[model samples]
Target chain A: MRDAYHEELDSIGEGLVEMARLVGSAIGRATTAILDSDLKLAETVIEGDKKVDDLQHDLEARAIALLARQQPVATDLRIVVTSLRMSADLERSGDLAQHVAKLARLRFPERAVPQDLHATILEMGQLAQRLMAKAAEVIVTKDIDLAMQLEQDDDEMDLLHRTLFQHLIDDRWKHGIETAVDVTLLGRYYERYADHAVAVAKRVVYLVTGEHADDLQQDIPPVTRVEGA
Target chain B: MRDAYHEELDSIGEGLVEMARLVGSAIGRATTAILDSDLKLAETVIEGDKKVDDLQHDLEARAIALLARQQPVATDLRIVVTSLRMSADLERSGDLAQHVAKLARLRFPERAVPQDLHATILEMGQLAQRLMAKAAEVIVTKDIDLAMQLEQDDDEMDLLHRTLFQHLIDDRWKHGIETAVDVTLLGRYYERYADHAVAVAKRVVYLVTGEHADDLQQDIPPVTRVEGA
Candidate 1:
């Protein structure tokens, strides 16, 4: 019975890593689809999101089943609950990628990204992919240091996000409002994608360290404090 | 013991309603702050979010404790797990409201919404608040019909979001890129806030009916089917 329980836990972890990989490929393809105006690729990425969503749903069900059957306590309990949340973060990351693909499909035949900003968007996409890959590694290995580094990696994506806005906000901006809206939404999608990756990594940090990432900063009190009424 | 467990479940439900009310008010005030350029009001909303955050943390801990102590099965287990997810949705809604307040502070003294779009934004904000209030009602009453209605209400927010984009995409768009970005982000914040509200309502639907909200839409298949290996 114990062996079966451990196997279930391992399966959940594997499912999360698989989800990360799928979403990472998704953003990469979605980026290329936008940069190259490949409508077919965008459609493929959009459809592929169903697989990620299915994986999340399956993982959640299995986790809940394990909770009901095993009645896990302490660290084991935390593992199941946190896996549910990590699955959610990864599922949302996939949705963000799909949104990118949908945007690409929306502007089909016309390049959504202008030539000058293409490099920044491409870099942002690459950074997002790397962050997810690292996030997956953190889930599998439970490497606290690697998990901590993902947040810093997210800062790079943030800088790229800001750069995209800088281009839009510059006085010399020539992109029409249509392009501006497209770029604004695209930047936001990538930024949010990176954020979800960071969130996944943070969950791993908490799972391993028993401390929330935010709690480490000490800027605010611990999130779960029970006081006598 | 059973009575104690039921009371704990009721407390969790009440906590969710409280969270919904706090977030609903936060968005309403944040909207007013932006529309009126009231910095003090914006600051108040921003600060008040801490209370919402703390409440969510407390609720999550209590729910998890109940799970551990009661080892609840079936509906009871589902209730605890779904409450956690609902709490997350409400907490995110609060964050979206805070983002609105922060943006208002960022553009201090300068109005975030232009004179022309004020009515549209105001309408979106009100719709978000109303949707959240309805979500709170759904949580307390577990009214599947009302929960189902939230998706339609969310459609109004989506339409308002589209209208903002239409204005931005028009050839006559005179708002500079900075204001354009601000407006774009603001629209997204409200749109996402409504999405979270709908998510909370959907959770209620699932909890009551044992069917996911998406499953009701025949366009998509059930989200969790494992293929033959």
Candidate 2:
């Protein structure tokens, strides 16, 4: 049986998974809210961000307290420290989801996305939500393969983002400058959301393998150095 | 006499200050690069970001090692954790600066900011750099009042951001949709740069006061709770 101290450590990791789940569902619902101009759903997502923030703050306080009380070293120390970083990433992801919902609220009864672009925006949203879901799964299972997969999903997100820009710059666009501005901002919100999800997965990879994801991907050895005096 | 352990903690804080200074100068140069379409200057900013990343990785490793070796409690512990967070903010701020430079490089000989909008963009860039300088100052001094001042600067940044949007949506916008897109992204990069700078200052305030900046901002007493079983 695990001691109480270890249980506390386990709880911090569990909190991260729960936070990721909340945000993953949030992006999915937030995407629907924006596309449909559902103010009610948007309101819930915006209000729900507080719960994510609170979880982070609580987890942070507990993590520090654990360090003070338990003083676990080596791998245990790395786990607690990494958990803090993961929580920060998850909290930021929640904020990005809220930004999407807030944009929906800003547009009110009117749709934020233009009709022709809705399909692309929807695809971006769905892909972003999938990325976050997989990130959460990686957190739970610590499967390095699952963590690495987020990069390809992010590349897909990038392709969709480029498609969005192409549509914007195309001469066929009949939308006014205001609509284009909204669309531009919306595209950014989704892209940044996906980036954060990928970052979370990378952190998991680092924790599991003791190597940076980019270093592993590019076959570059991480340099070892002592800080110069 | 202060021991080696405390000196190590002091060095971590110093490293953060150094990072803030590097990225602060980067934003200033990137602003010039974009305004003048100077590929050379933009290249320097892009390459310099690697230095910022190196500093962060080195600092993080040292921090984790220190946590393992020192096992600080209470205020000392908070300082180390907050340093790690502040380093992350500075590193991200560096990336934002590099994004500004990349935009400049992408636009090449063509200025990204059209003739009419140059003043606003320049102001945003200057304000972002100033915010980072002040944030660095706050990290070193931990002056509560100086830390509080970042909020006002951030407010100014938001106003500038809105002005950029206004220019984009102006009925007389003759620069076409492509320029509008570039301007929109530029505004976002600057605004986010300022936000990260403000975040760095707020973390310093949190470390010094043991109170969250937002909690203090609105006079909201932070809630106390015991985790439910």
Candidate 3:
């Protein structure tokens, strides 16, 4: 009976890992769709987001049931609680991706973002995706070192965010206000995506260290300080 | 032994309520500081935020200790978890208020935001504080109706957010791009403050209903649609 119960718990863990993968992939596709102005990909991401959402709800229900029935203790309980919080963050990441897809759909082939800013956004998205994957790997493999490294990965995203903001403020492109708004919002979304990825890493840290690391100094160190104007 | 444990839990719950009250007042003071350009009030909020942060950490540690020592089950476990989550949200709300205070500092005596926008911000801040207060009330009383009502309150903040965005986009002010950025950041901070308040209310919902509320949903009933550009 104990073996069977352990097996069930393992399956739930696997389910959470799968959900994280779907969320990570959705974010990547959504980012590509936005930058490339690919409506088809954007549509695909929009559709796929529902899967991420469903998987999240499924995972939450499973975790709650585990807590309810299994009466998990210590590390097991922490894993269940972390699963609940991580799933919420993942769902929000999916929502943010949908927001990006909607932006792509609304603007379409016109490419609301200027060409110069695209590279920065692309880099930020790539960094976010990588960090997310690392987070998932840590969850599956229980790699505390990888999780620790994932925190530092946010530095790249913050750098890209700063660059994107600087471009928005710069005189080039005749200071296009509308695209600037889009760019700023996109930067924020990517930054937040990376943040959620770091949050996953923090959970892993807690699972390993047996201490809550949620708000203990953000994963992303300051890449560049914004001088108060 | 059980009686002492219960008393400790009660004491912790009381402390959470007091922290909530402090957070709500901080929001009020921060908003007043913004509107009145009361630097002193802003400074007070900034300083008070550390107390909220300290309280948040204290509450989390206490909750964890309770869980570890008491091995609470079912509804008791849920309450502890809800309190933990609610404290995190309240901590973030304090951070958001600090962000608003930072905005106040940026404006100095000049008042970067126009008088019209000021009223909108004040309204948003007031609504957020009220929701925050109600969240604590619900937590204290386990009042589902009050919690549900707070969810609806977030709609006003969303509407005000959109209105503030439109005003910024209208570019009626001659203060130039910096003004726009500051206003945008200010609006973003207040909008997020409202989001945290909604988050607290949602936690209350989960505490009562054992299910997370759809936080993206603004108003509860008629689905009042705000015009989107």
Q: Could you tell me the lDDT of residue B151 within candidate 3?
A: 56
Query: What are the runs in model 2 whose C-alpha is more than 4 Å off?
Result: A215-229, B215-229
Descending-DockQ candidate ranking: 2, 1, 3
Tens-place lDDT digits, model 2, residues B1-229: 2499988998998999999999999999999999999999999998998899899999999999898998988999898888888888888888888888888887788888898988999999999999999999998899889988988988888777777777777898998887887887788778878888988899888888888865311110001000010
True contacts kept of each: 0.28, 0.48, 0.06
Q: Highest TM-score, which number?
A: 1
Taking the tens digit of each residue's C-alpha lDDT, what string does model 1 give over B58-79?
A: 9988988888888898888999
Worst 10 residues of 1 chain B by lDDT: B220-229
* lDDT of residue B219 for candidate 1: 13
Model 1 Cα lDDT, one tens digit per residue, A1-229: 9999999899999999999999999999999999999999999998999999899989999999998999988889888998999998899888888888887877778898999999999999999999999999999888999988987887677667767877887899887777887787788788778888988888888888888765321111001011100
Ranking by lDDT: 1, 2, 3
TM-score of each: 0.93, 0.92, 0.88
Strongest candidate by lDDT: 1
lDDT of each: 0.84, 0.82, 0.72
Which candidate tops DockQ?
2
Better of 1 and 2 by DockQ: 2
| Model 2 chain A lDDT-worst window of ten | A220-229
Error of 1 at A132 (Å): 0.1
Per-model RMSD to reference: 6.5, 7.2, 3.5
